[model samples]
Target chain A: MNHLTLALDTMGGDHGPHVTVPAALQALSVYANLHLILVGDRPTILTIMRQHRASESERLRILHAEQVVQMGDKPLHALRRLKHSSMRLALDLVANGQAHACVSAGNTGALMTMAKVVLKTLPGVDRPALVTALPTMTGDPVYLMDLGANASCDSQALFQFAVMGSVLAEQVAGKSNPRVALLNIGTEEIKGNDQVQQAARLLQSTPHINYTGYVEGDRIFSGEADVIVCDGFVGNVTLKTTEGIARLLMHQIAQSVKRNPLARCLSWLLKGRLKKLFLQMNPDHYNGASLLGLRHIVVKSHGNADELAFLRAVEEAMTEVQRQVPGKIEARLQSVLLEKSC
Target chain B: MNHLTLALDTMGGDHGPHVTVPAALQALSVYANLHLILVGDRPTILTIMRQHRASESERLRILHAEQVVQMGDKPLHALRRLKHSSMRLALDLVANGQAHACVSAGNTGALMTMAKVVLKTLPGVDRPALVTALPTMTGDPVYLMDLGANASCDSQALFQFAVMGSVLAEQVAGKSNPRVALLNIGTEEIKGNDQVQQAARLLQSTPHINYTGYVEGDRIFSGEADVIVCDGFVGNVTLKTTEGIARLLMHQIAQSVKRNPLARCLSWLLKGRLKKLFLQMNPDHYNGASLLGLRHIVVKSHGNADELAFLRAVEEAMTEVQRQVPGKIEARLQSVLLEKSC
Candidate 1:
C-alpha cells in the first residue's frame, strides 16, 4: 500500500490536543504507512507528544498555528479573522499538497467554509456536501449527504448533491452502480416540494446514474438504497433525530435494568454481547463525515468525539485518500455535465 | 366526567373489523363512561362483536355503512364516490354532533380530506395540521405537528400550526404554558429557510404561546420543549426516521441476544423488564395522530396498527374529547387572531 499523509487540526473540537494527539498516535500505530502533521499551539502539542512518547516516531511531525478557531465562531468570522488558525492551517496542508487529506474535529461551519475557500470545489460542482456513512440493518453502511452544510438548497443544488453522493459511494465504498434515492416525506411522485420533485426528474434523466425515484425516512435503515440525497436542512434533522433516538433508547434500557434485580444480574451476564451490539450501533463508530465535492479530501469528525472516534475519522480520510475520491467525483461530474449540455 | 361517544371506522386499517371491533370492545371495557358507534358492513361487525362476547354490552352499537373505502383510494375519490363508506360515516357522526370525536386507521390523505370537507376549519385556521405525541426522556410526550397533512407550508400556516399545537398541549396534556419550539436544522436564529425564520419571528412576538426559540431534531427526545412545530415534509420525515431507528435498534438487540448462549440465558431472565422498556418505546403505544385545527376532533391511527394500537388511538381520542380540545383550540386561536388583527 502507498503512504497516506493526513493533516490533523490538533486545536479543534471540545478537548483539542488532549484528544487529537492521542488519536493521531493511535492512527499511526494502526496503519504502518500513515504520517500525520499535527497543527496547533507548539507548546501544547509538544507537551502531549512527549507525554505519549510520540516524538521519536518518524511518521509524526508538528506545525505550529498562531491562532485557534473557537467552536462558537461563525464561518465567515473564522474565515476572515482566523487565517492562521489550526483548522485553516490543516486544510492549507491538503491544498498545498503536503498531505493526502485533512481531518478536523472542529466547528462544522468553520471547517466547511475554510475547506471550500482553500481547496475549492471540483469542476461542474457548485457546492460541497457533508457526506457520512450510517449503519443499516443489512450491515452495509448507507452514505447520506448534505448533513448540515447548506441549510437550504435549490433543485440544481440538490441535483449536484445526488451526483456527488453517488460518486462517493461508488468510488470510496466500492459499490459499483450504486442505487441513489432522493429523501422525501413519501415515495409517491406528488409527495415532496418542487425542489425535490424537480431534482428527481433530473436524476431520472441523467445517464450512468442508478436513480431510484424516492425513499422515505422510514426506509433509510432498511438498506434498500446505497446513497440517500437531500437538502442540508432535512438531512441534518434526519441524522440528528436518529442519533437522539439511539441515545434515548439506550438510556431507557439502562434505567430499566437498574430498576429490576433480575435485570441487573442478567445485564452483568450479557454485558459482553450487549456491549458489542451497542458499539456496533454507536454513532462514534461512524464518526467521520467527508466534505465531498472539494478538490481535495477533508473529513470532519464529530466536535465532541474522543480519541477512538477521532481515529475513526482519520481512518475514513485515509480510505478516501487511497480511493482518490475527489478525482473520481470530478471525472464523473464532468462527464454528466457534458452529457447534459449536448 | 360526562359520557364521551366515539365514532370508530370499523372497516378502516389493514385488518378492518378484525382489529377495530376488538379495539373498540377493549376500550369500552377500560372506560365505563365511553360509548362507541362502530361503522362498517353490518354482518362483519356483528360477527366480530358476537365472537368477542361484546354484543351483550350496552355501550357498544353498530351503524351500517354499505360502502367501504379501500386504503388506496385517494381523498378526492373517497369524497366523491364513497359518501356512505364506513370512514365517511364515522366522520359524519362527529360532524352531525352525534359523537364527540372520530377515530380511524384509514388512508391518511382520505381521512384528512374527508374530515376537512365535513367538519371545516375553525374560525382562524387556514389548514388542519397532523399532530402526534412522541415519547421523551422525561416520560412526558412532546406533541409534534404537521406529520404529513400538507406537503408545503408558508410562514402563516406554520404559525397557525404552532398556535394549534400549543393549545392542544395545554388543554389535553394539561400543561399550563407549554414551551413551544420551531423545528430547525440548527438552534441559531439564522439557521433555517425563510419560512421557518419568518415563523420563528412571528412566534417570538405572539402572546400567550411560550415560544422557546428553535429546537434541533436531536433535542426533540430530550423533552425540553412541550410542543415542536414544523412543516409537514420535515415533520413527516423526522417522525418516520425516529420510528425507523427505534425498530432497527430493537432488531439488532434481539439478534445480539440470540447469537450468544449467555446473552440468550440473560435475555430470558431480563425479559420482563426488557419487554416493558420496549413497550414504552414502541410506536404503537402512542398510535393516534390527531388532526388538529378542524372544528371537531379526528384521530388517525397507523394504517397497519393492530388491535392494541387501534385501542390506543381510541384512548387518545377520548382524552381529547374529555379535555374538549377542539373547543379550547377554537377559543385560543380566535383570541390569538384577534390580538394579531388589533
Candidate 2:
C-alpha cells in the first residue's frame, strides 16, 4: 500500500493520449503514493502534458509504444500484427511486474486479447471475465459479469464467474459474505438453459458461495443480490441494453420539455437538480470495468470516456491494486474448487 | 375488418375482475363494431358491471369459468389441472370460432402454454415467439422477440423469428420493407456465437428478409433497425433489464428532487410536464406482448397491469385482429420456408 504503480494505455480509446494524459496527472495528484507509466507514442504524451503545463517527476515516467490500437481492431489481428500497440504494452508492463495494474479506455477486444495473451489467466481460471459494479436503487452497487469477455461459456466457466464476481464484490466493494445470484430467465415459469441450470447446481452445493437461487433480470437493480452472474453474451447485452434505455428516457424527458414554454421555464429553474440526476444515471460515470480472473489487474474504461471518466478508471485500478484483488481471487477460487471436488 | 370480437380473461391478473371488466368495457366503448366475451366468475363480472350501473348488452357478454390461473402457476401444471380456468377459457373462445382473438392479463406461463396448446402454432412455424414493440428515440417502435417464449433457439428458429417479426412490423406497424437485425454482443470487436453467425448467414441469403447484419443491445432504442431478433433468454433479459434501469433512474430522480426544497417546489410547478415524461417511460404504458406464430391471435398483458394498461392489451388484440396478423405471418413464413427448401 506504500507504493502503487499503474500503466496507462495512453493511445487507447477515442481521444487517446489527449484524455489519458490529463487523467493520469489528475490521479497522481489525488493519490500521492501512486506512480503512473504513460504507454503510448511518447511525443504525443509529452505534447499533451506540456499543453497542461506539466512535466515528468519521480512519480511519473513515459514508456514509448510504437503503435496504437484502433477502436475497430479485431482482437486476434491486434495480437498478431499490433504487438507493440499501446494497449498491448500496458498489459505487458503489468505482466512483467513493472506495474501493479493497467487501465485503458481503448479497444475492448484488443485489450482483452492482449491482456489474456500477455498477463495470462489466473491459475484455475479458464478465461477472464469483464466485471463491473452496477448501481442499485437504495443499496450499494452490485457487481455484474462476464460483460462480453467470453461469448460462449460452459457451466464450469459460469460457476467460476460466480466465484470471481463474489470475490470482487467483497474485496473491492467491501460487501461481506456478499450474496450471489445467477441471472436466469423466467419469473414464475420455465427456467434457464442447461448451462445456467448446471451453474446453479454447482453453486447450490458449494459452501464457498452465499448462493441465493436464480434471479430474474428485473431484480438486477433492486439490490436483492450483491453479485449477479451470467455468461458474457447475456451480461453484455443486458449492460448495453441498460445504457440504451437510460439514454432513451433521458432524451424523451428533454424533448418533452422543449415542446412547452411554461414547462420549459419551470424546468430551467430546476436545471441544476435535473442535471445532477442525469449524471448519476449516465453510463460514463461508471467507466471502469476490471477484467477479472487475470494474473494481474487490468481495468477497461469506456471507449468514449472523458478526462474524469478515465480518471475513474485509474482510481478503480488503484483500488484493485491496493486490495490485491488477483491474489485474493486466486486464493479463494483454489479453495472453492478444492472444496467442490470433495 | 367490419367486426372484431376479442375474448377477455376477466379473472386474470392481480386485480382479477376489477381491472379486466373495466378495461373490456372501455375497449367496447372505443370500437363501435367490437364485441367482447368476458370469461370469469359470472357473478363477479356482473357485480362490477352493476356497480357502474351497466348491464350485459349485445356487444358484451359474460361466460362462466370454473377457475383462474394464479400468477405463480407453472406452465405444465396449469395446462393439466386448469383446463376450465379463465385464461384457458379465453383462449378456447379464440380457438373455436367464438372470438377472433383473446386478451389476458394473467399468468404468462399459463397463458402461453394454454394458448399454444389450444391454438397450435402456425404452419411452417416451430414455436411461437413472444413479440413486443420497444420504444425508439426518433422513429416508430421496433419489434423485438422472443421475449422469453423459448429458452433456446437454433439457427433455423432465429431465422423464423426474423421472418415473423418482419410480418408483424409490416402488417401491424404499417412499416414497409422493415429492416431486420439479429441481436448480438461485442461491438466493434468479436462477433457472436455459432448459432448467431449461422442465423446471420441465413438472413443474408434470404431475399424475403431485409437483413441489416447484427446489432448490439445498445442499439435497441437507436431506431436503426425495425426488428431485432434474439433467443428467448437473451431477449427476455434485455427487455427486463431495460425496465429495471428505467425504474432505477426514475427512482433516483424522484428521490433527489424530494431532498431539495427549492427543487421540489419548482418541480411541483413543472409537475404536469415531469409526470407526462414519467408516464412515457413507465413500463405499464406498454402492456401487451403478442404471442406471435400462434394459429389464433393472443395478446398477453402484464400480470400487474392496471385498468388502463389492461385496456392497452385489448387495443393491441384489436389491432392484430384487424390486421389478421396470424394469417399474414403464416403465408409469409410458408413462402420463406419453401424458398429455403429449394
Residues B96-176 of candidate 1: C-alpha lDDT, one tens digit per residue? 989989999998889999999999999888999998888899888899888989878899999999999998888878888
CA lDDT of each prediction against the hidden true structure: 0.87, 0.86
lDDT of 1 by residue, A153-223 (tens): 88888999888888888877888899999999877787789999999999999986899989998888889
C-alpha RMSD between model 2 and the true structure: 1.7
Error of 1 at A152 (Å): 1.6
Would you estimate the TM-scores of all the predictions? Answer: 0.96, 0.97
Candidate 2's C-alpha runs over 4 A off are A187-190, A282-287, B187-190, B282-287
DockQ of 2: 0.72
Pairs that collide in candidate 1 are none
- Model 2's i-RMS, to one decimal, reads 1.8
Off by over 4 Å in 1: A56-58, A271-276, A279-285, B56-59, B282-287
- lDDT per residue as tens, model 2, B306-338: 889999988888888888889999999888888
Instruction: Give interface RMSD, every candidate, in order.
Output: 1.9, 1.8
